[model samples]
Target: MKVIVGLGNPGSEYAHTRHNIGFEVIDYLSEQESIRLTKNKFNALFGKGKIGDTDVLLVKPLTYMNASGEAVGPLLHFFKLDTADLLVIQDDMDLPIGKIRLRQKGSAGGHNGIKSVIQHVGTQEFARIKVGIGHPQHTREAVVRYVLQGFQGDDRAAIDAAIERSTSAVKAWLTQPFSQVMNMYNSNK
Candidate 1:
């Protein structure tokens, strides 16, 4: 079984925020697969289903961004799965807006959500799809405010396109080997 965990803060107040792009991709995938994320487990809102014969569990950790491991760790134990079976989708501030990168293993790159997952899972060997949200144009302290804000004007379109592409990359990961998917998505497009 493959567990696709989207890292994001819960609640409507966080909806459409740059930090919630991970959740947005999960929503897009759930909609495409006709699955409802109504069940709660491991402190997350998730849906279990199959996409093209690949058993998948889509998760959105409710414990918020900084403490995502609280949900992911238990789920791994409950499912009797290894870190290799997990795929975390999250936002990256360093890349250009709308860009994405797939990796088989890596550090959190200062992302609290990914850091929490690494802490709980005890390994960085899992697959991941990182969607770029870009950084604020002004002061570096504005990072917090930037991630919490919703996309605006031209950014709205780019982010929307990235979410769709992320959904597609996840779908590919469900069946294709990680290395193949990585080679296909990790390069600049």
Candidate 2:
């Protein structure tokens, strides 16, 4: 079974924050695919279904952002899943808003949540789909505030479009080869 894990803090206060973009996309996917991510398992909000013919499990770890690996590592072990069978979705501060990038493997780039997963799993060989949340300016405080804040006006529409693109990207990944998915989705400028 393939697992798609969306990383974010769990709470209503974080519902619309840029840092919760992963949660938002997962929520969107669940809604569009008619699956309910209500099952409480592996310390996560989860739903099981299919994308095309591929059986998939959608997971949003409830251990919060930084400690996300605690939930994912056990789930992977329980399911006897390889890193290749996992796709991590998270918000990226590097790229501009609304863009998405897919990578087969890489460093976390200072994302504490991804770092935690890498530490627990002892590998960086998993796949990832990063949705850009746009970078904040030079101010340190602004950077913190930017990620924790919700999108407004046009940014909301852009975010919605990105989520839709992510769903299509997942379908493509399941049906086509990883190289094709990478080629098609990596330069999502």
Alpha-carbon lDDT, every model: 0.91, 0.88
Instruction: Flag regions of model 2 displaced more than 4 Å.
Output: none
TM-score for candidate 2, please give it.
Answer: 0.95
Query: TM-score for all predictions?
Result: 0.96, 0.95
What digit string (tens of lDDT, one per residue) describes model 2 on residues 59-122? 9999999998988998899889999899889999997788899888899998988998898788
Count residue pairs with overlapping backbones in model 2.
0
lDDT, candidate 1, residue 48?
91
Q: Could you list the CA RMSD of all candidates, in the order they appear?
A: 1.2, 1.3
Across 1-189, the per-residue lDDT of candidate 1 in tens digits comes to 899999999999999999999999999999999878999988999999999998889999999999999999999999999988899999999988889988889999899999999999999888889989998866767998999999888889999999988888888887889899888887766
- Residue 13 of model 1 has an lDDT of 99
